[model samples]
Target: MIRLRYATMPSNGGSRTSTGTIQTPPTPMADTSTEPEVQLRMFSQPRFLAAVRALVGTMAQRLGFTEMQCGQISLAVDEALCNVITHGYERRPDGQLWINFWALEGEPTGLKIVIEDLATQVDPDDIQPRDLDDIRPGGLGVHIIREVMDEVNWERRSPKGMRLTMIKRLQPGRNSELKNE
Candidate 1:
């Protein structure tokens, strides 16, 4: 199990953003097949979204992702987190959400971001983006996430809540490699 502590600072409960940094090094776990991950936990509030965006963008850049790729990854992550804050936590500012960002190793390296929340359980099959042709302001987050991410999956967590996993391939020809013949 992953252990992390997030220190919450005072916020205006509006547009202000609070960031909690985890200085702990990524340690190899028993599951050797996957790479070690850096964990981040923060309050589920609108104000903290900016901090999450910055963290994911910086991590992507440091992992050799181009400016465009970093932006795409950040936007996708932002949408995911926003969904957790809005739908999962039901806009409760005091609720907590956990995120794990890591890079895959070996043959074809890529980025993976996992967001877990304990507010509500969501069925993967029930998630549906609004029709793009409808052109509405309130329902495009899911569409944007799908367009930007190479792979997007929603998993119902045991006990409660759900986990949203978003992956992006940094290589040029990753699309072809990830596609089935």
Candidate 2:
């Protein structure tokens, strides 16, 4: 099971411009306590994918994840974002997507990433990867994310949104491949 403590969004709430850029970073988000969580709100535009991936990759690296594991985590995050943009938002550009990155603590140290989208709400049970036998040009994102992450959970957010939680734990026997300078 994956357990993580996340921070509450600022009381004032936050807003994003039409271009999907935040006018100001929210307060109470950079809690550097034990949990150390970061929340990012952006549009489902393809142009923001690189920045999001870089954020996830850097966080994974700092959390003592191996180089390959970091890549896997980043890939999983990318796929999740793409899935939200494509399937959830139906290729819409203005849809808002929020991602929360949590640094876990305890016996199995790891990272937890939550991708929440306020696009189209669907039953979590209905979301799954297509049959591999069909051999399609796409539709492997769910498969890849499930394979890479240690724990994955999906839920329909209250009102109108979907939440995807992914967690990856560092193996006890393996040491971190990257170190802080």
Candidate 3:
């Protein structure tokens, strides 16, 4: 996994403060190897959805899923993120969406994905897939997600927002190093 590093510097050409001393901020170091790799993005806009989809697709492929399966998984993830932007954040571009992807560390040997958003929380019980009998341009996200992933779970965050967890087991006969943690 790649590491993201950032360091803070004095804003005023190294000028001393009122106390006649300069202070340095601590550098930020992230332990990405053992932790679930995380990506923070702004998805409250319709335009950014494709990039999100591409990212998910790439990750899915990297996990040894076939191209076709990657597309399906990516589409499901796209729909879920769209719902987060439209419903959870109410289409407000300022809200942040956090997505994490990791290979499980135990028996299952599959991919694990978790999406989190600091937007309005929705009751998990209130979420349902639209009836297929009625066709429409919208409201099929929940259904698509359930259809593609082996496991789907939604939860309201403790203080605010919501989390969606989706998992897919390794394809039959395929071997992978990823396992449940």
CA lDDT, every model vs. true structure:
0.72, 0.75, 0.71
> What are the models' TM-scores?
0.76, 0.78, 0.75
Pick by lDDT: which candidate is best? Answer: 2
- Report how far off residue 144 is in candidate 1 (Å): 1.2
Residue-pair clashes, model 3: 5
The model with the greater TM-score, 1 or 2, is 2
> For residues 95-179, what per-residue lDDT tens digits would candidate 1 score against the true structure?
6777877676554677888877777887799898998789757878898899998898888876677778888877854432222
Best by TM-score: 2
lDDT of 2 by residue, 1-181 (tens): 1122335555579632232333332232233353336667787788988887787888888878878988899999999999889988999888877777777777688888878777788887887888889896988998899999999988877667788888899899655443555
Write candidate 3's Cα lDDT for 69-164 as tens digits: 889988998899889988888888777676667766456566777777778988899899999999878999999999999999998776788888
Query: lDDT of model 2 at residue 139?
Result: 89
TM-score quality measure for candidate 1: 0.76
Model 2 misplaced stretches (Cα beyond 4 Å)? 1-36, 175-179
Q: What overall lDDT, based on C-alpha atoms, would model 1 receive against the true structure?
A: 0.72
